[model samples]
Target: MLRMAAILILALGAPAAAEPLARELFGAMAKPSAQAPEAIGTYARGCAAGLEELPESGPTWQAMRLSRNRNWGHPEMIRFLKDLSLTARQLGWAGLYVGDIAQPRGGPMTGGHASHQIGLDADIWMLPPSRVNLSRAEREKISSISVRTEDQTSINGNWTRSHHALLKAAASDPRVDRIFVAAAVKVEMCRTAKRADKAWLQKIRPLYGHNTHFHVRLKCPQGSPSCQTQKPTVAQLSNGGDGCDETLQWWVTDYLEELRNPPKRKKPDGPPPKSAKTYVMSDLPRQCAAVLSSR
Candidate 1:
């Protein structure tokens, strides 16, 4: 009886053994399919860096925290800060923050759905008032009082030429996946970036937009479980669908027409898709069932 009791106590005190790798495989697959191996790796690295830079408990972190219902992304924020440091250094700006971090509650403009929910969004401060171009001076003055309270008037009026430059520089960065700026600012920055660096321009243009405050999104890193593979959508040809030959001709004609006269501003029809939904599962392929069962 004593020996049996000792064995029971010992068993109860011992830690459970680590689950087999097969269990880990099942757990991994149970998550959203968008989670790619490469993306997951990137996310892990990003999260580690974010944790180091951002304290788990603090006023700054609390203020920046997203609603509990949303999926807050740490890795994205880490990459943003890393990239912003480089951008600010090159552009001669002090730093980037959503609002005036110095003023406690002071942060960047927030209205509509900025990617701020995911910790990836940031509102960079515009250049000092003195440096703003006189020709566009009227456009640059943002009412500080109105901005703090989430006023739309203040948001629309506050954008400046310096802000445009900062956004342009950020958008041109290779790591930037997309940028949403005010329509007017997008046009100006797109044109400037295109002239300065054609490759960056091409990459950034498709992701461009005009909103009150600029929203910056970085590319899904190499190992994010949430990242999805995407391809440009083409209308599927049906029995009498728009034929390929006709579509090709139409594209050629439209391209030539646009080449002749470029507009000052172009608005997107709607917000861009935040993530790709399509997925290809390696483990889920036909041959996997036998292998999985054997194991």
Candidate 2:
């Protein structure tokens, strides 16, 4: 009886076996092959360590939730937000959204093509105070704020000249990688923002698109072995004359198609080339005084 009782106690105290790490886990989070575990015990230990380092608050943590569908971004995405928030504040913009809480009725998801699932990407509403002509109370309501789907259209109407300035400011910030704005707005911004600051315009252009709401992308944080690297490109201003109306239309169509039908993952045929430098607001020509004065 004594021996049996001792055996039972030992069994009860022992830990249960750990589960294996799925390949999807590594792919989704962009983990490198070397660090991945071969055994279930090692994998669990790694996961626990990784989770421990993740933030408990902020956009990435706020956005995290268990779901049947696969979309949540990696844990490092939280760190990216903290950095972005600080950078954006310096340039005079408000906070970012972890999800599509403020997406206009029929507007794209908050992250655009990048999955908002992990909360690394966010949408910064281009609420430029100069254009809205709203009272202090109204401005407060719009900043770092979210709205229901029903209220999206009304908020979009608020995108004005001041908002454009704010967007330009945000794009010019060194930390920002890309921004998506409405097509008409993009055209208008391309004209003036490029002129106002050539470097900023170049940084923002390739990352620019025609979403009703603005999407902000930041660099992948350190310690995340799985992050994708994008090469920066030189700034390319849209020809102010609207000469590429057909090209714009085709680009939008193609972008939407890719969004709906994302390509399957495959090994590249050659070494990944460096990403071209994007056209941010600062890249615009200084000589275009006429563009800024008109705005």
| TM-score for each model | 0.39, 0.40
CA lDDT, candidate 2, residue 95: 39
Cα RMSD (angstroms) for every candidate in the order listed: 15.8, 17.1
Q: What is the lDDT of residue 236 in candidate 2?
A: 28
Q: In model 1, which regions exceed 4 Å deviation?
A: 1-72, 99-161, 191-196, 203-211, 229-295
lDDT of all predictions: 0.33, 0.35
- Report the C-alpha lDDT of model 1 over 1-295, residue by residue, as the tens digit: 3323323433455332221222223212211122212222121111111211232222111112222112223454545554664555455544443321111111111222322322344444333222222232333333222111132112345554556556666756666655544333433444444353444433232122234234555565554444332222112221222222443344335543564566577776896532111111121222222222221
Model 1 TM-score on a 0 to 1 scale: 0.39
lDDT of 2: 0.35
What would the per-residue lDDT of candidate 2 be over residues 206-256, giving only the tens digit for each residue?
233334356655444455443343443223234443223454454446654
